[model samples]
Target: MNKQDALSIVETHLTKKRFEHTVRVAETAVTLANLYQVSAKKAEIAAIFHDYCKYRSLEEMMRIIETSYLPKDLLLYHHELWHGPVASIKVEEEYGITDEEIKSAIYCHTTGKAHMGKLDLIIFVADYIEPGRSFPGLEEVREMATTDLLKTAWMISRNTINFLMEKKNRIYPDTFHAYNDLTRLLDGGNHFEQNAIGNIETSSGSM
Candidate 1:
């Protein structure tokens, strides 16, 4: 579906605050898409659908996980993280989202992935640093998005991992893989030395 169409579909079910966040994510995703030379339309689609299942009950999330064809690795993760991927499947079947690019963007938006596409990176980072997000260091990432999308994503991934680790939460394996994946990309390049190192200082004193 097109951008407006996708937004309308999501707006119908999401709460007002959630819809606003989705819109902000769409706007931010488009900004990142332009900088990264990705398709803005794809970024918009991904952003709009990124939280399509956020309001679903935990029981419903589990039911989808059980039958949504999620990978064995993804199943090992909790329902919260698994919800995004499973939601992608439900959105596809229920909302007529047939494009694999958009589907993959939605699927990987939560716990990024190895060698992500430009649109996927945009959706992931946009969701993290959208205008309404006031988490510590969000402004840093908001600034990084303009000149260094991949590095920004890497840092965000690191922060996310650290936050979960501090809460003693179940760290999704995809998150660790995503951090290493982006680090690999940076190591393969030469522009961002600081970010390439992946030094995220956590409350636990690990860097």
Candidate 2:
């Protein structure tokens, strides 16, 4: 689908504020996709639809989760986690969007999983670092995004984990898995030192 068509369809499902956020995310995702050598069209489409199911009733989301191919364990966690997986299926059934790469990016955009593909990383980081969001350590991640996609994703995953930890929330296991996967790729299992990112704080926004 073209960008205008995609955005129009997505706008109906989101609040006005959320639609604006989606537009910003699509722009950011396109930039990241170009910088990181991913498909920009896919990035834009995935970002536009990333929050498609965000405002769905909990009962409807739960029904989709229980009936669809998504993991049922997600029901035990916060309902916020349910939207991504449900949207993954909805995009296919509603829009005839059968692209696995786009579906995977949409499914895992909220809480990234291990071994993410380039397009997945693009949507994940774009959603976090978009201009509409403001959180700790975001500047550092944005700086790194221009040079290194893996490190940027790692920073986001780390900040998100720390934020959830500070709130004493039960984190989804896939989130930690994303951090581990990116850490391994960032510096071969070594930690990012001050010389790299320079005392970046944790993020608590737009996860």
Q: Over the stretch 90-207, how does candidate 2's per-residue lDDT look in tens digits?
A: 9998988878778889999999988787778889999999998887678999898899888788888999999999999999999999998788867574333522322322221121
Backbone clash pairs for candidate 2 read none
lDDT per model vs. reference = 0.78, 0.85
Task: Tell me how far the alpha carbon of residue 115 in candidate 1 is from the true structure, in angstroms, after superposition.
Answer: 2.2
Question: Candidates' TM-scores?
Answer: 0.85, 0.89
- Candidate 2 Cα misplacement greater than 4 A, ranges: 189-207
Clashes in predicted model 1? 0
Model 1 segments beyond 4 Å from truth? 72-76, 189-207
